[model samples]
Target: MPNRRAALLALAAPMLALHLPLHAADAEQAPAQLTTVPGPFRADAGSLKTYQAPAWFRDAKFGIWSHWGPQSVPRAGDWYARNMYVYGSDQYKHHLAKYGHPSKFGYKDIIPLWKAEKFDPEALMALYKKAGARYFVSMGVHHDNFDLWDSRYHEWNAVKMGPRRDIVGDWRKAALKAGLRFGVSEHLGASYGWFATSHGYDQIWPMLGVAYDGADPKYESLYHRPHNQPYRNSASWYTTDKRFQQEWFNRITDLVTRYQPDLLYTDGGIPFGAVGRTLIANFYNASIANHGGKLEAVYDHKDIGSGEFIREAGVQDVERGVMEGINPLPWQTDTSIGDWFYSEGYKYKTTTEVVHMLADIVSKNGNLLLNVVQYPDGSLPPEPQQFLKEMAAWMDVNSDAIYGTRPWKIFGEGPTKAAAGHFQENTAYTAQDIRFTTKDGALYAITLGTPTGAVRIQSLGRKAGLEPRPVKAVTLLGSATPLRWEQGDDALTIQLPATLPSAISSSFRISF
Candidate 1:
């Protein structure tokens, strides 16, 4: 469980006025006021319970997220900003050799190194669209306390530093030009605590007791102001420092007000209780105005449970996780190619694994928001670009099974039992693993791998009585000829044609 969930449970109510201590010494603060835009939703739990996931988000089952930012500058994987300050850590040693010590050169100095000179949004968006991304999300703000957009509330932004370009705005334009929905992800909710490592000095001999650059008051804005707390990850991860809480609200509110994104993804759950809820209400109201008085905005809240709390307000998201079975409500699984950011020599997920994940997620009434890591200079790496090309080829023929489809009676029938939950991304599935999706008059049975001969789907068996409708035709998606098949009391068996549509994953279209 995450810190937010624990905090929510401990609250006497459903996180009403989820603010920190109001004492002057603690930095007095309260929830930011809601936007003037009138809408059906409100900050209250009762009002937000009526919130609905947007139709665009439901249909856009596959989205590509640019989880890129200055953090990619090190090419040392995720948490570089935090880990670089820790003595003897991989990123720390790398930074010490490549740049300098944290006391002299901190994360603030690394910001200016991210000059995305080669970033061509048009080309990148084209690749993503071809890779079957119906929606694209730009990193709004990450835990490094850097805003990827031109921020009015924060000076540490892309427009002023790093790329000196409006990364989020440019990505949105490219996404729209390619006829895809655009969204923004904000990881700023936990930045206050996530960045606390920067405030520390090296524990080792050469630099022991010497404060890092973040200890200086001049860099406090870049690395958040100091807090008195242990590094233990808990509900406290969401800081109780009221001023920081209000800062989170103000900056994210500015992002929503300026960007008016089709979707808004908070890295954590309804942040700062009323503060986060109010921002969500404001985002929804703005989206309604932009869409001719209709609520077409999706608020992504990370909910690993029965989607009870988040389903009341927005689309529930699971990070690097899968549901045991089909989710009753529409959900999303946000994962990355390797780490959240580009890492040196990272072994990426194979094309087959990605296809399997997509098929499985869509079958379980969920979407896959894969993070395609980017280089610091805004250019696509060769390996990930190749990965996209392969994915595009697979989607070219099987997209009909993925897009605009709903889950069937069962998610799938397989010998491999997936350990479902957060951070469990890998599952070994044989050709026997079959996933199902239904659209109109068609039922798509997608095998995780190429079936050698005859394949049996127990879930479709006559005795199992799952599929009441008689099977009229069974054909491989990329093939024109119908496959010879049988529906018996035990299972639905089908013979494979000489050629297969995709070796990565096969989708058999069953018409009844």
Candidate 2:
């Protein structure tokens, strides 16, 4: 993850590193840990080489995740860390009004309010499976310092507090029963820097002197005591503490060893030290041994200076965005219809929007992990429910074209393009865009928008001087009838039969 000023910096020159030097072409640096270790795969298992990402994740293009946790308690947006800082943001305003002033009602108080009253792991798993999720990941913990599992390392967990339930455990069980691989996300790595806001406030009385429970020693492990400044100092937010770096490494190791997560996602870069990288290597090797080397594992951290060393660290996860251009290596993009957490009056993406986005992403050799914001009580809002239903319906009709498919010569032929960078603004698509994917010699052409007449694909047609390869058959997914196609020298034309099978974007399989 880039720093707080990365966007602005990107507008100028590329952001300069404050900690390490810019990664150069001949960079000889080893990953954060275990430079001597060999990869866990059978080919490299003879020596102590670092581990590399498993093949299953690179091939299994689609997976789903349950990002919900105590943070959803307020029924607001995610960003609980940053919003809790700004004095007038919707979340900040809500926090001041409902709980008390910011100085008095810190987010720590928000913990006890999280009652996963309606949480039903089985039901949610069923819905996710119907939506075409091949694997399921649940939040093990977030930056809020709350653990969703029964943790022996940290008692400030679901079983010990608010929900008084083993949220992650139940989710794992449900995912396994549904025949989906189980994974866990740990945002704890960034808490040291991101949650520094909790230390900022006024100094007075019931409304002043008190900070969030972070300063208290009882919660130090949960909050991660940074050594750069005294616990009570106001300067803690700006200062970077090296001690917390080690703390991050230790806690993550604990998380991996106990849960043995098939997939592990760090919210940001794996902690600053080589130790964190070592833990990652250990996790991959151990998981392989535990599962007899057949069940592959994944570790999703940010793209830390790409190289053979970084690739060995784990898979890259883009949050709310995707990599630019055609990346041969597999990747995952996670986004939500509205907020990452449930909110009142939240507008969701139309079914057309989601389906088109999925088509575009899959064609680009990436998987889409769509996060739906369920209410704190575990009940999904009406809009989210409808969104999931529509997605499931689309998948029901087009699953064959999406799952287990590979990209064709081109990802798509369209004017409507999705964002190409991290944290970039999302845009809508038009009828001109067409994404392409392939499976078993079949070409899946996805129209980004609804078209009323014949569609012309220049890449599919013959030239004026010569005949193009003829399309043996053309069929719109979800429909039994075959459509007529003509191959001209310059384009392949498929005539629409007056109406589309669905209101959303439609796709057709062209067999050569």
Candidate 3:
């Protein structure tokens, strides 16, 4: 099998090589040069192999993301644009009932409905900082092909249409004001084919013969022209069309050039082969130019574990999933409170679930980028606001264990094994489950749930085979006095106080 795989890769070498250096030559000749030489990244895996995640990204463990956009306008949750085109789908029915048929009132009509009148970046940024977010990410563009930022290339943008505001710029200003790193997420790569559904017609309808608005050539730029294949095909995620690829390159390049965000997140794996590589290279090169030769920018994309190109170029981002153990390199998990976009009646993850997930991910050398859903009017409902408040109160007492910490020898001690991969169910941790993180020679043992009378950590036992270090001092994070503890060969038992410090997870700082 290994020999066969190697033979296939060898046969594909020429095809892969065709994608290299597409923009490297042009970037080298640009008049306003960002770097003396060509950009730091290249389209091939060889050049990107030198990339490493920066220290700032590794330290800024927790980040808040606003996945807000016109898709939330209908309050029907994620994939509203595409799903609304899918015949017999819930969104399709909702669109038909709410406004009209796709032939008349489509996603284009929904764009103007996003007023964002209640959206106050300054106020939201303050809440995020208080909730312990070290970084903020704003939606630059989703699969709908609408730019949330002020776009110079495309006319379908936030400034000209929805909200009449540069959403990315406002979020960036707010994040910087709150001393938080800012990032942007671009889902445009898959959008070309993803939005192909817009060009489709209802198979069984009174208007069956009539085509959707996407078929109109006047709006072809906004609703992308139909591709050869059906929607949601794996290969179609990043379309094979050269015209679309070039457009993707131009728009993303404009985004990086205009914003110079601290981080850039691609919704899928590095896309469009050579064009994608050029985008990453230009991003890094521009970042270095902005930071006086020190690249502070970080790029994140999905890693399927088979692609060396993704593993080498940027931080691996798992969508609604987790790594099984401590990854040799830093990575991230981008999940949301409820639906990716706002849904009228969606249930959100509780604060306890979020905190426990954070601790578990951090213990495995991972960061969490959580999306707090917002309404179409740009306001969070009572439930999400309460969620943020709870997070703030918890962070007030236990943030020392979360920020600027590294994984310990072992991630945790627990019986409930967390299922690994995207879309897996969240683990329900018991009081016995414990996660570990460390900083400045101190170990922090975070109990997933508050224990009653006594807490025992088997990982710290003398005979646990980890060659465990002797505990010299142990103190509860929010408590003033030290706790009484005894170490045995089998387990380390600590007598807990009748009352706990925080209502959520409890942390014990251990010094050797």
Best of the candidates, TM-score: 1
Better of 1 and 2 by TM-score: 1
How much does each candidate deviate from the true structure in C-alpha RMSD? 5.0, 6.6, 7.1
Cα lDDT of model 2 by residue, 1-512, tens digit: 33333332222121112112222321233433233223453323222134444555644566777778767876677766445644345676677777776555666677788888998989988998888788888888776667788776677788988889988889888988998877888876556545544544433354444444444555565555433221111122222344454455556666667777789887665555445556666776677678776537787766532112354446667777766555676677777777776777777777777787677778887777777778888888888788788888878887777877887777777675567765653768887788888888888888888877888887787553222456788899888766877887777888888667767778888887
TM-score of model 3 vs. true structure: 0.91
- Global CA lDDT computed for model 1: 0.81
| Residue 290 in model 2: lDDT | 85
- Which of 1 and 3 is the better model by TM-score? 1
State the lDDT of candidate 3 residue by residue for 1-512, as single tens digits: 00111232232233223312233232233222122225666656787767887888888899999999999999999888877776667788999999999999989999999999999999999999999999999999998999998898899999998799999999999999999999999988878756766776776658864777887888999987644533333433565666777778778888878888989998877886767876788788778778888878888988532112368688888888888989989999989999989998899999999999999999999999999999999999887899899999998989889899999988999777898866664889888999999999999999998788889999888989664568898899889866889988988898998788886789999888
The lDDT values for all models are 0.81, 0.66, 0.82
The residue-by-residue lDDT of candidate 1 on 268-351, one tens digit each, is 677777777777888888888888988999888875321124576888888888888998788889998877788989989888
Superposition error at 248 for model 1 (Å): 1.5
**Which portions of model 3 show Cα errors greater than 4 Å?**
1-37, 304-309
By TM-score, the better pick of 2 and 3 is: 3
**TM-score (all chains, Cα) for each model:** 0.93, 0.84, 0.91
